[model samples]
Target: MSNLIQPGETLRVLVFGAHPDDCDVSMGGTVLRYVQAGARVQFVSLTNGNKGHQSILPVALAKRRQDEAEAAAAIFGVEKYTILSHEDCELTADLATRRQVTTLIRAFAPHLVFSPRLCDYHPDHRATAQLIQDASYIVNVPHWCQNAPIRGVTPVIYFVRDSFRYPRELRPDVLVPIDEQLDILLTALCCHESQFFEWLPHDKGIREVPDADHPEERKAFIRKYWLDVRKQYDRNRFFSCLQERFGEAAKAIGHVDAFELSEYGNQPTEEDMEFLFPFPVYRRETWKTTGQRS
Candidate 1:
């Protein structure tokens, strides 16, 4: 086995977000926790978030968001912040986009890959998820694309949590707590002031929070809204599952982000699971607590 799989090896991960703030919102805490545990993490935004703000020019907003992302990455000790320069709100899971993602996947060659689910309300999120799924196998196919170097080994893939419930499609087999990394996540989140303070609610069809009336309360409301999206909706069960797998170390925490182990990529072994998921997991006995199993 490689030294990276050793007891104290630095776990590496690659996170893909459709927008500038997607990773921060969806898996920020997990990112923070990974860093805290001596993991090397990187962020990739499929788009520059040029269309993220109002009362600002597109070019200017993109640059601002990029700067903010860099600052946030610094806060989390992220090694790199890669922007694909794709236009926001118009992202498509085309061949070109998939190829770009493949290159990053090969270049990073992370043990784990995290990205949005295919069922999100946002088109960009859905597109990115599809792109990731497609590229999951493409990265390992030597002859798939001759131009770029192929990553022969397929890394384990996982999907980020979505708050919304859409009838009968649920695939999450694991949850990782972010409570330990909440502070770092928040610090990174604050970098996207434009979206969190201005645009996310507005774009989500939520009424805008006016600055004149209880600005702090409005900020609190927005924060809570995101927290609900990120934390509630089976997050607790996820933590419980982590507790089962990782024991007390992964438990004894609050706030969890969920993910569905992807069936499209390489199937990780027990050892891989031990490395990639260093959290307590749900046992048959504990399964009753959540009325579920992993």
Candidate 2:
């Protein structure tokens, strides 16, 4: 089905992540752009993020993570942030999980859905991908998820790029430049204090949290920490994608997010790409001759 959004339409987006901060880390900038353009977005964490902290107990950690997620959502003006009760580090692509995802899809009726790439280091990330893939078509099936109304068309699904490498590589179908939204993205990410300051640093064998009790000092450290991480993992490829699309001017873009189309959802055309991304498309000569937005 060609479920392409038209120009000037208010789009609906649903993003699924394995844990609380995953969505913000991967596509927070893109979500910011969408919201600025008046799109409605729902960020859903498939797991409770109970296991994220190195020291906090599961119950307390889960509540803390949920509160963090809510705070982050408020930063983006996203009203519908959902965290499923599934235990952290234990997500599975089982029948029940698929049904739950399908139910959410039908209830939201989003025009586009985003999830982690199938090739991921974390099992929960992999499982979340499988659940999204399994639910893509099922959401459109009449008999599935009886409590929710079946959507007439399946949402277009895209997978966020992961840092891990595999024997068979995954390539991005779209690169969304996020330079303008970098500060906002970092602010949203900072809300996930448990992950950024505690869990990730412990996982990486480094002390990420600063000793300073001042809020600005802490924010500065988190911003720099993530910027360094992004530079190490994604900066080069993101620039390459931008250069390929918009030529030399892309070098000015310092940050970006990448996404790959999934086979399980709506097949988008070139026109669909224009509608969905709405970024300034530039040809080398066009930018060189006339400094105008394409």
| Candidate 1 displacement at residue 45 in angstroms | 0.7
Q: Write the per-residue lDDT of candidate 2 for residues 1-294, one digit (tens) a residue.
A: 235665466678899999988888788888898888778999999999999888999999999999999999999878688999999999999999898898888888888899987888899999999999888767777777788887574677888867666754556567777778877777787788888778888987876466437566666676677764663356575556667777878777766677777767876665565566666632122112321112
The C-alpha lDDT values of all candidates are: 0.74, 0.77
Off by over 4 Å in 2: 6-9, 231-233, 281-294
**Model 1 misplaced regions, further than 4 Å:** 1-9, 201-222, 236-253, 279-294
Per-residue accuracy of model 1 over 221-288 as CA lDDT, tens digit each: 64577775557545564555666666767645557777777767656655566677665533222122
> Model 2: how far is 135 from its true place, Å?
1.0
Count clashing residue pairs per candidate: 12, 0
Q: How accurate is candidate 2 locally (lDDT)?
A: 0.77
